[model samples]
Target: MKITKSIAITLGLAGILAFKQDKEVPVKAALQAAQVHLANMAAANTDVTQYPRSTKKDGSIATTSSRDWTSGFYPGSLWYIYDYTKDKQWETLARQWTAGLEQEQFNRATHDLGFMLFCSFGNGYRLTKDPKYKDIIIQGSKSLISRYNAKVGSIRSWDHHTDKWQFPVIIDNMMNLEMLFWATKATGDSVYYNIAKTHALTTLKNHFRKDNSSYHVVDYDTITGQPRLKQTHQGYADESAWARGQAWGLYGYTVAYRETKDKRFLAQAQKIADFFINHKSLPTDKIPYWDFNAPDIPNAPRDASAAAIAASGMLELSQYTGRSGEAYKKIATQILRSLASSAYLAKANTNNNFVLLHSTGHLPGNSEIDVPLNYADYYFIEGLIRFERLNKGLAIVSTGGFLTVN
Candidate 1:
């Protein structure tokens, strides 16, 4: 058999198994494989490093490199470890990663604090019931809310550069609205819920294409509070569908539906999922291109992050709809198996740490295009946990058409 890079990588770290005549393979083995991969990744990030803010086109600090909220995924990655294992060592690492994030809490500007802190500290508090984690999440939520624009009725994004966009709203910002939802539930504050609902409505109306796939960014008229143009900044072109953006739409709408129980959100989630699953451009392993229409596929590398995020959404969908028949569970299992066996990096005691591999950051500068990504690791772990929980016969209650809870 001709072994491709993906197949070779899968065969290398974990041995392949032959199926017996009539018995189905156990899901626990796959979960154990994911756990092994997670353990290896956790061991890899022992060394401490600080990220410095990089320079922008305007000769000012662009995005902060050192513990900025925008650099949220790595710390979020640690939180996954803490959640799955309940290991003190993982907890310790999560604390160390979050200690560095304390500096950004005071900035109170960017919309990514939810991605940075909520996935880490907010999850930490929710899982452990630690007051400190609650405080951290509250502060991060406050910071996220400060970026909301009363004029546009949505959160502002991209403070650094861009002339046509003053209160630009990006599809990625949809993931951050969870902080507002959480605030409303935690503090009994309706304002946060109203704001979050408004943002979701705005995103539903503007950010999505006809096929339910989405643009990376949407320019909104700050004065008139109308959508000016739908565009893509971090994709192949302004009109193209970025794979991660699609993943965001899938996961975000599922989450929104979970929160609101809105059928519209559920419909949107299914639409995005259909677009992703039916795309012929997807790799043989069912992982996706960085951009669906990138114009250089076959040779264009796949984004494992996109696959991981989509897998998480699929598992949630299976639980939401209560139809874990062959087709639904089979695809979910296939994705989990591929990620566990193929993309996972299992080196120990190094700083080049990540779980899911072959993640494409971007293609514009040909930098970090098809490498290990932190968000991929986070979502992959979440998917595994969801699978494990479901396989154990845990009943999932659909919170809205978007989210699932035990």
Candidate 2:
């Protein structure tokens, strides 16, 4: 529960004192800075079909098609900016960027439709109440559920690497469930809700360790409905705890608790949060190395994307705990402040026009090491928005009455 020690050293004596005095999160300045960076990114990346994913080794922006799993994030970040600024310009740009991914509503081949569709269209619909966006979201949910196996009680994650895994389900799939929950909320059908709930329960049963940290991938046998392999495809080793995988578990379970009001999910989320926050490897600034168990400790590349996602998720998790959640909020605030600092935040027209820097995408593959990533920016903005909402006594992201649509 103590965040002041390391955070004090990272942010200097003023920040340590601010933590003691219960100071504001400085969301306005962060948001204002983000707007300028977003504008630079928007101007630089005009091709909607190719969303900015990350920077290449040669210092150029790497772009991916809408078919890429990360395609939704750029548009989703735009929607968040629009929500924060309420400017017609950002809305126009959000719509433009979002429209390119409409074809992905039927992409059932991958288990990432929720990330691909929901993050973009869901936020757009939430902000604008656009009927077209709503329809796309419902269809996208249907597509996402198509990957669900009744026997396995979980959605399949990767279609590739079949030689390695029979039915691979990665921890990142937890992120896509938020859209399914939203779908059932939008419509009165329980099919989406049931699939999502079952998936969460199945993952809850199979994913965590005794210490509450999660494996990156759990390969299930198709016939017996048992885990064939519980290993790490992205971490340092099969037994290593990947930093982003842990973030995904924390965010995923938090959403599960939010959608279902299930206390088990809440308890699981708390345990995961405790594991992440209290882990010995977490740095003084609260940003974690790409893998907690990486052999190169203290020298491993940092994943700002993981830190941003955890910050955003913990902000929401903080809201559910009342006064007991203050510590979670404070830790999340420490992460946000570190991210907003000059060390992480990219200057305008720099970092290939991306907002944040130093995210590790896939270390084992030797790809995207210490580069700017779109999702890091997305979640950093999201964390700022959530903090500002809490400051103003508003519900974070407006669930539209939780279970009821009207």
Candidate 3:
């Protein structure tokens, strides 16, 4: 936690060497480029009801309604820019986008309020200490916990996959538990914390294989409270390791460890991190293919979003990994450096103004393959900020959330 001056200098030199872009600082330059892209996106996406999700095949900005799981990321990205620049203009833009999701606080149908509300209003309240945002987060947490089945021991992930699953839970649900932790912290309620802990424990018990790679979906028997099916909804096959799913598991367990300080969670996070970092299929650049088991191998599409998420997660996990922390941070630096390169980072005023490119969303469903995604940009900016803070001997993240640095 207290980075020594010598260690800080070493980290800074390591980051610079990782990029090797002459005198250009990778984090600063990427953030400057991100600001331009975000400003352009804000101008182009004028409708508050719709959020930027990804780009269409025709190279246009594809959008989603506030109910979509990804709706919070764009606003969250705005908040990150504000956090970095401390500019009121970015704050205003962030607030306007965040305000649109206020009504989602009561929507009980989906388990993504953490992604939809916490990422937006949660960041807003953290930065500004706004009581209104705090209230929205509390209400949203209640809505999210409403989906928690006592018998199943996890929040239901999707309502539409009923025919294929009885009580379905996805590994991505791990990301939602942070808001539950926030709820407990905000309201002094043990109920939210208990539910979050139970869900995380249940996931830890059933979601992971022996090797630490996770199944995307675990369909549980509602009556027996046991998994009936372990399969993939988006990956290559039932037994294959999905790239983004692995990232979610890695990131999610790291968060669990942070909130509860449970050594089990910590160990689980490290195992997942090791599985990902040491995977045989991972490219030299640290950007993973869409699926580690994808039949195409080197011909498979690279998922920049997965790389971004894992890098951000590993940066946080690195702080807690003791002697392995440096190794974790080294791989994370490689990922961030790759993402900031010309191959992944989009040109100014191009790629529909999205900051990064080559993200794969729902490959089995044949959707949003190899496109620029908002969440990729969100986490890329977050990783840059975390790395910069780490090198400067500062706190890598605020206690309020995992994305921002103090």
Candidate 4:
């Protein structure tokens, strides 16, 4: 029973190896690690939160206070897990987290129920064929529809204390239209499709800069559906490209193209992807910084989350464009490899629970600026799983199944 230092180390290493072998490795192992991180986050803050935002001086998270309605990634995190694992535990957690958003959904002021509900319950229903989740998703989509202004032909972005701004449309809002499109398909309602199409068309007309990189925010005339100003709200300035916003535009456009087969959407997606891939701002590793114009090149932080999202979008794009997507496929694989090599935390280490690291949330405000983001972990694992599925030549599941690139 005498334990020497070398013997102790050998036994400990063996135990760890045994544990890892007992469980699944690769994507499943990474998913479990992400869940452990989420659990730790939930235990630390009585809130079973999805994505953690930066805190104010008053110790309050900014996203929690503002009704600006751009919170998308968190609940979507749970939905991603539920779909990947098909675990009832994840489904239960998704439901529980969604329950917290009931008041927000009923407010009739927020425009991102698609981000909040569709990514959570809308996805849940699609995967599990659960009627209750579908009901909630329908209600949430209707709430989002009520924010649409017929005069402006765009959904209102924020209804907070700003009475001066009306029909503010951010490029990021384009992603939310997916829920509306889903509502039209699920319920056979043409109104939802019309509204979604209107928003996409309006964004297409106003959001893109001459460089094909997009503006972060656009102000639309509430009365005549005219473009007032193209500004950058969360980016470096009114013109600089925010890396995450670009990923959103790329991913959103690809999804829109998938839904409508609108040649225009595919073209926009290609343009954005081209802009992103050819940008000088992209790091050698293929991961991008929070702002493409962030000064201090060597010291600039990498947003692994943005890379993960972009990788998934690029893979989707590869499937859309037959032979033209080869470059995107290569870039997507490079980004995923970089993430796995640098940011991914192995499951053997119990001290660090998060699967992916070095994700920048909001560097300007110094909020979760360079930390392991939950959504980063979620999307990294998702990209891996999807890549594996694609390599296996698996069919892309239409109903809550693994979405793969050809």
Clashes within 3 Å, all models in order: 12, 0, 0, 0
Give the best candidate by lDDT. Answer: 3
Highest TM-score among the candidates is held by which one? 3
lDDT comparing candidate 2 with the true structure? 0.85
lDDT minimum window of 10 residues, candidate 2: 397-406
Clash number for model 2? Answer: 0
- Give the range where candidate 1 is weakest over 10 consecutive residues by summed lDDT: 15-24
lDDT for each residue of candidate 3 in 132-194, tens digit (9 for 90 to 100) = 999999999999999999998999998895787898999999999999998998899999999
Error of 4 at 304 (Å): 2.0
Alpha-carbon lDDT of model 3: 0.88
Cα lDDT of model 1 by residue, 1-406, tens digit: 1213353345224522321221243234444344444444434334334422222334332233534644656556556656655767667766666666765665676788777777766766666678877776777777777877777888887786667676688888888877778878877878777888788888998888887789888877878988887788889998898999998888788777777888888878778877888787876677788899989787777887888888887777665555533344566667767776634443322214344557777677665665666677677777767777777776431211123452
Off by over 4 Å in 4: 1-29, 39-75, 161-164, 344-354, 397-406
Which 10 successive residues of model 4 have the least lDDT summed?
1-10
Candidates 1 and 3 compared: the better one by TM-score is 3
lDDT by residue for model 2 (103-222), tens = 999898999897788889988998889999999989998999999998899999999887999899899998898888888878999999999999999999999999999999999999
TM-score of candidate 4 on Cα atoms, chains taken together? 0.83
Candidates' lDDT values, in order?
0.67, 0.85, 0.88, 0.69
- List of clashing residue pairs for candidate 4: none
Per-residue lDDT of 1-406 in model 4, one digit per residue for the tens? 1213353244335544544663422444445545554444344445543334433445443335213243434555656666666767667666666556554556577777776666666666776687877877778788888988887778888765366455678777877888787888789988888988888888888899899888887887767788877777776777888888888899889878877788899999999999888999888889998888877765788788789888888877888898888898889888876775524453332323455767777676666666666567656766766665666677443223345433
